[model samples]
Target: MADEVKLLGVVGSPFVCRIQIALKLKGIEYKFVQEDLANKSDLLLKYNPVHKKVPVFVHNEKPISESLVIIEYIDEVWKNNSIFPSDPYHRALARFWAKFIDDKIVTPSFKSVFTVDEKEREKSIAESTEALQILENELKEKFFGGKEFGFVDISAVFIAFWIPLFQDIIGLKLFTAEKFPNLYKWSQEFLNHPTVKEIMPPRDPLFSFFKGIHDKLHSSSK
Candidate 1:
């Protein structure tokens, strides 16, 4: 019997999106339960008591928290469309970059773009830009995993999708084709992937929502 799989996630969360993309890539069918972060559901709380976060993956009734951990679980369980590399060293490298993205890139980038304080924003932008440049150098091939969208690719989906939107909302240009040609090209390809294209929400509404958040943050900071 196939283990029943279900995902609790928020609509626009990049962490949640990571799991969604991984599931899609592996062709795994699962129920998606959207969570309201402001009023988190009882199920979400029950499944993820520690974080109380979205993106709690329940497989065979066992809960797994953390986006990257869930992605690794999905890859292990559904081996048909494997995302992680088969070799030990290659897998380690993939894991290293994925961790770097979460710790060094995505976290600081979001903080920089969303924070109301100018000094913090500048600091985060410098940190995130440096991380992005490192990633740009790492991408010697078409994708992070080289010629295929794999673990590192899935881990860095936020850079491919949300960064551009955040840049527009904040009126900043952090990523450019000329400055980071490889990453810029990777973003284009990642966004255009059939599965990715299918799951992405319309740009206008997303931008409007982010703009409202941006305004709220700035107003509150005043």
Candidate 2:
């Protein structure tokens, strides 16, 4: 287990943070390589030639891209702690939630939160809030995936971490203590866990980074 491990990721991406959390949870030591999204590293290009995205996991000498793929890879390589369900059905359910968040929640919510137009913003917000509510229902009494911390937990972990920051920045309360009481409280629990707490990025810094990303995205579009 002496092979060199290096992670090339942009500091700001929640996707990248997902990879970081996976590595930390597994107690895997690796060199952290900060990448400039504006000016990508040769390693990122060389590794993930297709999407050329960050949060690329380099194990030994091979590179793996996509946060979820990286997470699964990390879990497989380091067996000290497993983050997925044991039963076949449970594993599929957990994977369903993860894919739902990726395909259903994250992108739509992001669009809603960052739109400049009020009407468009409202529409996006409605869609985002509906998605959040659906998630709230799913999380009614469940804590973590099947038995404990696993794939679903790791997959949606960013929602707990970034929602607060995004709420502040967007000036809209998508999640509320009264309205989404379970999720609100669950967030506190998840964020306070020693493992999550240690690896979690500062809220202020994440907000600042997201603001930069929002600006950067808008800047290039216009």
Best-fitting candidate, scored by lDDT: 1
Instruction: Report, for every candidate in turn, its global Cα lDDT versus the true structure.
Output: 0.90, 0.77
Candidate 1, residues 171-204, lDDT tens digits: the string is: 8898989889999999999889998887776778
Predictions: Cα RMSD each: 1.0, 2.5
**Regions more than 4 Å wrong, model 1:** none
- Per-residue C-alpha lDDT of model 2 across residues 1-222, encoded as one tens digit per residue: 597999998765778888877888888889999988789878788988999888888989998888888888887777788887657887778778888877666776677657766687677677767877887888845465643567777777767877667777767777788888877777777777788778776778778877887777667668
On TM-score, the leading prediction is 1
Q: TM-score for every candidate vs. truth? A: 0.97, 0.89
**Residue 215, model 2: Cα distance from true site in angstroms:** 6.6
